[model samples]
Structure formats: structure tokens, C-alpha cells
Target chain A: MTTKRSITVTVNGQQHQTEVEPRMLLVHYLREVLDLTGTHIGCNTSQCGACVVMLNGEAIKSCTVLAVQADGGEVLTIEGLAPEGGLHPIQEGFWEKHGLQCGFCTPGMIMASYQLLKNNPHPTETEIRRGLEGNICRCTGYQNIVKAVQDASERMSTSAETPVPAGD
Target chain B: MSVPAAFDYHPATSVDEAIALLQQYGDEAKLLAGGHSLIPAMKLRLSQPEHLIDIGKISSLSYIREEQDHIVIGGLTTYVQIEQSDLLRKHFPLLPEATSMVGDQQVRNRGTIGGSIAHSDPAADLPGVVLALKAEIVVQGPQGKRTIPADDFFVDTFTTALAPDEILIEFRLPKATGSTGSAYDKLANKASHYAIAGCAAVITRGQDGSCSAASIAITGATVRTIRARAVENALVGKQLSETVIAEAVSHATDGEDMIVDIHGSEEYRRKMAAVVARRAIMRALERI
Candidate 1:
């Protein structure tokens, strides 16, 4: 028998109160309970990084974290990246650079890139490649994905008044 | 999707609370540190603890401070914090460098040093590095806190000297003094990013450039991380040149039951252990 845990989590600036089993994973809670299916589950292990999300502004693998573990934390999925009418720079870069083939790994790649670019507004080519190491893209060979991140960094740097520095 | 079996989750806020929870649950409970390793093991059914005492939220256990003659890092300090620490980068570069090779950015953001040490994976990088640095770990239990030397901490594969009711608190390492250098060299398996063979070496050179003291530790070759005392003995009092260091590091794989799995054969691991040790020694010498 499993015990159900009631948790309050803020997702993409919205507060959510839900009851979940202790064994329920964050990925399932997002997909099934809230119907936020943008976070994909690949390999079902932490290594793949297909289920990456922004937990309190840090990129984390949602598949490895239980729903109860994320209580009282802020989570940002790929669904929240774009505005009501337009796309975020990261999404725009993906569209412009054709960052995906099968589109399975795009959400995780975008979320991971969101954190990377937030920290480093302008990263070197090697830095861009190394930054995306956590999010694996089987389709595009990561060339376009790298280009997309670089493009997003460029776009974001030109738009924001004061760019945020990488954390200590 | 892989899901963990049914278990009770308890988020602990303090060390005393954590210890008390551990005492109540006994061996059926597992401490949840960053959950980078524990979560994966639980999801795969490799570990099925009835209760999980999460120590991640205990702010008191997350710190890195410089003491009188040593540096004390709290058990919950994440790898990302260690990697970005200017103090660690300037003083103990090997720790930050080795931690950078742990996993991708996300894994480092959540994996804690104490959790890694307690897990004690033979292929893990921090164990060998800590062993080479002669770091001491603090474990707290019902009785009180006790310090355990790095050498005696690791008992066997996936096992440590930690009792069921004990929790590792922090690691204390003596500050690196003048003429001391350390390096960690690893050959990682591309798929999982676990080390195939890793070697950590710390050397202190005299004014004459002759090695005064040396500590060489190896992982991924044996069932447990161990110091290569023969290699250390051969390097001391000897000028650290290419040939001399090479000869000394040749003993890294001696007298050990090397791990043989799909990654590499026993012979292959032995050969690579020597190679990594040689590289690590050379790097350490260069740093000195």
C-alpha cells in the first residue's frame, strides 16, 4: 500500500495544489496530473536528460525527482517558455536554426539551454557545446542545436537591459 | 516509465532530526542526499528502502568553510558549488576538476560530495581523490560525532563503515601547503560517463625538486578505492621525471581484484590504471 502526499508547487508562476503518492515522480505529476506533457521521459533514467526542467531556476532531471520532493518549489517546463502570442528567443532560435528532427528531445534541450543562456548571455562555441552536454539530441547531431543556443544567446543579450551573470 | 516502489518519505530539517529518523527506521531507511544516485537506484529497483529520510533541505549541512589549518565542507555541498568555488579552484584544483568530470551540468548541480562518498562507487571520482588527499569524514549517530579516516571508510563495493543509525556530516581536508600538487585523471565511459579507470595523485616536492611525499589513489580498477602505497613509496625522494614517475605508477594495479565488466576486461583496466596514474603523477608534478 502507498501513502498519498499533498504538495503545493508553483509551476511557471502558477500555484498548484495536488495530492500525489510518495512514489509518484515529478515527470508523471506534470504530465498526468497537470497535463503539462512538454516534459518528455527518455531512457526513464537520469542519464538521458529528456525530462529536464527548471527547478527554482536550476535545470534538473524531473524523472529522477519524486513529486513529493519538489514540494513548495517553483518548476518551469517547456510549456512556459513562450508568451501568449509569440515565442521566447530560445524557441525562436530552434525554429530559425531547425534544432530538431524527430522533436523528441527539443523540450529538454530548450529548458537546459534556457538556464545556460540565462547564466552566460554570450558563450563561446565550445562553451555552448559543453553547456548542452546534459541534454542529448539523437536527431540533429547537435550542430543545429548548438547554433540555436548561440543564436538565442545573441538575441537575448541584445534585447535585455542588464544581462544576468552566471551564479557563483 | 521506471517508478520507485512504495516508500515513506520524510524531509528532515536538522541533523538531530535526521539522526533520530535514521534511528527509528533502522536499516530499512535510506538517506536521500542530492538524489542523483539514490533516485536512479530506487527507480531501477536496485534499492527498495521502506522509508526515505531526505536530508537535502537541511540548510545547516550545506556549507564550505576554511578552518584553522584545514578546509571543512559540509556533507550536502553540491558538486556544482564545489566546481565553482574560487577557494577550491585555487587551493584544491583536483577536487573541482574531478568534480567537473562527474556528469553534465544538471547532475553536478544536484549531486553532493557526502552522498558520493557514502555511495562509495568504485568507479566514482571523488572517493579516489579524497583518499589521495587524506581527507577525514565526520559521522554522527546516537552516541555522538566521530571522525573516520578516508582509508578506513570504504569497506567494499557499495558499502562503507557507516552504521545504520549514522549520518556522514562533513569532510575535513588539510589545506594544501607550498610545493604540494594534486591531479585527477580519468578515462570515462562515453555512454554513462562513469570512469573506466581513474587515478588521483598528490605530491609534495622539496626545494631540490625531489619528491618529499607522494600519495597515489586508484579507482575503477578495484572493488574499492585504494591508495597505491607501492607507487607512493617509489616516488618519494626521487626526482619526478617522465621515466621515474612512469616506473612508480606501474604498480597502481598490483595486488587488486580489478573490476571486469562490459566496460573493459581485467587486463585492459590494469593497463589503463597505470596509464591514468602516470598521467595524474605527471600532471601533479607540473602543478607543483
Candidate 2:
């Protein structure tokens, strides 16, 4: 039999202390244990983007990461993207640009887009396509998704008063 | 979803600790880097080992630096880190270019170079690139540390020279000489991240503007990434012309033992390998 271990992790800006089995995936911990089901598991394989999340400010597929691997680390789920009453620029862009049809891939797509924008605030259309190549959206045909990222880039660039350095 | 079968979890903060844990567990233990590959396999029951030694927290094993004679990349350095490193862009542009093509942004964020090398999937882009670059793999075991050339590092399909108690530390690539350039070309599968046929080429031009040395490594067309000696032999002492490049590409799959699957037939892969190798070599030569 496997042993259960105590792990302390910060999820979506909140600390959670829990005991989990060695086999528990970070996706399971987020959905079943912490009740943050915003992170969906589309495919057991890592091919799908439905399980994408931010660990230590980098986008990763949570389904592939074990909870023990994430011990003592800070994780950002789709829930954390819009912590305040207002939606994040990416989320707003998705809605305004009609980036989704069934909305199954939205949370992961939005999280992936957030990471891309964080690193390259203003990405070209080709860059945006390459950035999101891992995220498979079965619906929408990706026309609006690319449009959403472009819209988010424009909105973010205009809202900022102080100029942020390129390539953050 | 039922939980992954029972397995012990050992979190190691240092290389020594990780090596010790691997020794204690023997062949029953597997090192977990980003869990991008092993974990998914475990979930599918393809690999049901007794223990998982987690090494993701070893922050010291994540860096990309330029040494006096070579570029050293920590084993735990994520693909995303390589994609963003200015050092890689300046010294090893081919590595970053290939890394950028790895399974999207999410996989790049979690997959480590070491993990990918250790897994040694024949279709993986890095293995082929490293082979062409003539890189070296540094491994730490219970006994001590040793460096294995990239050619000898990959033993067979999904296998490496890594001992049961050994942990791959980092990879080192010698600095390119003057008039040297490299390129990686991959025909990516639409659904799965596996490559249909991938080729990596490194070419060094002579003082007379002719090819002095050439190395071409091919992946996804064979059981393991193998250098195309026929192509390399044909390129040396030849001008970087379209005819010579085509002749070189024709011999790319001369000695390859290719893998045939539903993705493509062995005949198709053999043909594509030749085409891609020529394209990659031509592109590399253009940059020289």
C-alpha cells in the first residue's frame, strides 16, 4: 500500500494544507480536493490544453504534474485569473471577441494566453498561433481565439500609462 | 478517475539525495522531473513503477550558461527557459528553435531537457538535434559523475546509457566554429505531439566557401535518431549547391531502421526523411 503525505501548497493565492496519496495528480487536487473545478481534464494524455495552469508563473499541464511534485509551490488556476470583480483583460477579450462556442477550452486557453501576454505583451499573429499551438479548441476553428489575443494585446497596451519594458 | 497505482514518493532537494534515493529503490524507482511524460504513462499504466523520486524542486539544476569552450544546460531547465534564454539565442540558436516547436506552450513550460533526453523517444526533436550538435550528457550516480557523448548516450528505442542509480545532470554542446550553422526541420503530427519525420543538420564552411564538415541526424524515421553518414560524406568537400544538397538528401535513410506505425508507413517515412534532411541541410548551409 502507498503512504499518504502532508503537503502545503498555495493555490490561487490561498494556502491549503492537505494530506494526499502519492498518486494524486495536481489536477485532481485542484478539482476534487480543493473544489476548484475550473481546471478541467479533457484528455488523460497531455495532448489537450484543458488541464493547463500556471505553476510558479509558468503555464503547464496540471494533469501531468503530481500533487507531491507541486508541494510548497504556488499555483494559479482559471479561478485566480479574475480575482477582482472585474474580469482579466484576456477573459474580457474572449467574451467580446466570441472566442468560444461550448466554452470547454476557455479556462485553459485563457490561462495559456495570459502566460504568453505576460512574457510577450504584444505578440504578432503568427507568434500568437505558435503560442497557442498546444491548446486544442475543438470548436470555433481558432479564428476568434486569435482575434481575442490580438484584442487583449491592444487593450492592455492602451490601458497602461507607464510603458513596460519589452520582453518581460 | 481512479488514482494512479500505489507508489512511494521521495522528494529530493539535491543531486546527492536524489542519487541515494534511486540507489535505495534500485530499478523500481523512476526520477520525476516535470512529469510531462512519465506521469502520463503511469496514468495509462504503461509504467507502473514502485516509487517516484521527484527532482523538480532542485532549483540548482535549472540553468543555461556559456562556459569557456561549451554551452552547459542544467538537466532540469524547462523548454520554456531555453526558449527565453538570451544565452541560447546567441550561442545555440538551433536548440531554442527546436525547443520552441515542442508540444505547445504548456508542455514547454513543464518538460525539461534532461527528462526528454532520458526518455529518449526516437521521435523527439531534442535528441536528434543534440546528436547532430555532438553534445555530451553528464550523469551523476552513486559511484560518481561521468560524461557520455550524445551518440553513445542513446542505446536503443526509448533507452539511454543511464544506470539505475544515475541521474542525468546536464547537457553540454561545444561552441560552433566559424562559418558553422545548424537547423532543425520537423513534420509534426496534428493531434499527437510526436513527430512524423524530423531532421537536424550542422554544416561548417571551409575558407574557400565549400563545405568542410557536415553532420545530419534524423529522428521519427527510425528506432533511434541516427546520423546520416552517407549525407555527411557526400557534403564534405562539395560546394553548397542545390544538386549536392539533393544528392546528400537522397542518402539520408540509407542505413536507417525506421519505425512503421499508423501515422505513416515505413516507405513514406523513408521518403520524407530524405526530403526533410535536404531541406534542413539547405537551410543550415544558407545561414553559414
The numbered model that scores best in DockQ is 1
**Candidate 2 lDDT by residue in tens digits, B1-288:** 735678999999899999989888898999999887788789988889899999988999999988999999999999989988998877767788888888888888889999999999998889998899999899998789999999898889999999889999988999998899888888888877677899999999999999999888998888998888898999999987898898778888886788899999989998999888988887887777
Report chain A TM-scores, every model. Answer: 0.92, 0.93
Indicate the fraction of true inter-chain contacts that candidate 1 also forms: 0.80
What is the docking quality class of candidate 1?
Answer: medium
- The positional error of residue B154 in candidate 2, measured at the CA in angstroms, is 1.0
Q: What lDDT tens digits, residue by residue, belong to model 1 across residues B5-122?
A: 8999898999899999999989899999999899999998999999999999997888888888888899999999999999887778899989999988889888999999999999
lDDT at A76 for candidate 2? 88
Clashes in candidate 2: how many? Answer: 0
Top model by TM-score, which number? 1
Q: Say which docking band candidate 2 falls in.
A: medium
Please write out the lDDT profile of model 2 over residues A104-130, one tens digit for every residue.
999889988988998899999999998
Give me the overall lDDT of model 2: 0.87
Q: In model 1, which regions exceed 4 Å deviation?
A: A161-168
Query: Tens digits of per-residue lDDT for model 1 on A23-94?
Result: 899999999999999899997877778999988779999988888889989888888776456688888889
